[model samples]
Target: MKIAYTVAPGRGDTDLLLFGLSRCLLEKDVRATGVVQINAARDDAGPCDMDVKVLPDGPVIRISQSLGREARGCRLDPTALERAVGLVETRLAASVDCLIVNKFGKHEAEGRGFRTAIAEALSADIPVLVGLNRLNAEAFHKFSGGLATELPPNIEDLACWMTSVTAAKSSTA
Candidate 1:
């Protein structure tokens, strides 16, 4: 049950940190699977489009929809998000050493997204790494049942953690 998460202080920093960490782990030949975000800036000064790159050479999916700039509600394309989730879920059964989910967000908070995937990874004895935000902190705590460890936002520390965790998993395997 090696579950870990990080809440970066800067806006969109968590996404960036997780993306880099995931790529680093994969380059190290760690069998990692999950989704990491890639936000594209908009020319109209609107919110950046959110896209997620599935782990282990999986496809990139756009998870955000551009609602009018004034729209206050969620711009998340649930279907697209689920597509990414489905892809990640499909890869979970393979020889995965770790799972790196970019966000434990509203969907997960409502138990409609990566929550089950995270649980499945734990059940399969695979280590899990997730990015979290403050808005969902309470829900994540409740969902994790106080078992998830908080990781530092720095890439070096995160890579170090991933390296150690993957090495341990490899040894045990």
Candidate 2:
């Protein structure tokens, strides 16, 4: 039941998205933690009743790791970057149950930091639920093309997605 929500720089309201998704799960009596990018500001002290684990220095590590991975097979030293990525993944796994990709907004795919993290999350087998914004629907359609379905706008959509996926996984298990 773990998930990871990733986002590109200057993307959506990751904290709010995480809070809203966690809130929806709470209403359904499902316990879930919202993992937001480390260092993002949030006013989650309101009505939502769910756990929030903010990665304290996610952005810095994301950059360092991305550079490291990119440098691999090149003349540059990649050891530091490898350690950075490993640290991020380790910390992410230690804190949250799953990862939510919170940055599927307009022009998000252009970010190297975000893209690299998504790759790492996938390699780690962390389930990624991409949250989209209205401003980027057209762009998303163009990018996702035939693979994308029209998702209802809002964090509640996560409930439906999670339920169906969990059911399928359970059936297979």
Candidate 3:
């Protein structure tokens, strides 16, 4: 299943969640891929250089609008949010089977919220799994219609989950 693993700011560990899900799906032979952040200003390094294809978080229009709002000391206009949402939607179209929106990656410009992107994702025919901190796994499962799975806290948990997915799929098949 194509699952969009998103998180809120200080919500949870996105890196771990993405890595875990990727490993799980791969072990299950589910043809998994990912879209993550790439630091445009820095040399290619870290996960960006990993097997997963990385993309820039914000494009020129969003950046320009954001900068304009900051300079004017005004709140982010709906136009900016719409443009930002459009950027994400466009990337998601031909990008991955699902979107793992890094909602917590950065703060929103005033009047902007991660919901903009989430709403767009919801409109698509993909499953979205939001990661949250403090909330128990059960809550997540409930929110995601039991499609949600707990994120691993360490390498061991990650490996186990991957193995489980693989085994489950194998048995069912």
List model 3 lDDT by residue over 57-135, tens digit each: 2333322223331254433344654555565656656633344443322222222444445445545543333444443
Instruction: Provide the clash count, candidate 2.
Output: 14
Model 2 global lDDT (CA atoms, 0 to 1): 0.44
State in Å the error of residue 155, model 3: 8.3
TM per prediction: 0.96, 0.44, 0.37
TM-score of 1: 0.96
The residue-level lDDT of candidate 3 at 16 comes to: 51
Of candidate 1, the 10-residue stretch with the lowest lDDT total is 19-28
Model-by-model lDDT, in order? 0.90, 0.44, 0.41
Compared with the true structure, model 2 gives a TM-score of 0.44
Give the higher-TM-score candidate: 1 or 2. 1
Clashes of each: 0, 14, 0
CA RMSD per model (angstroms): 1.0, 10.5, 8.6
Candidate 1 vs candidate 3, TM-score winner: 1
Top TM-score: which candidate number?
A: 1
Q: Write the per-residue lDDT of candidate 1 for residues 29-132, one digit (tens) a residue.
A: 88889999999999999999999999978698999998998988899999999998898899998888889999899999999889999999998888899999
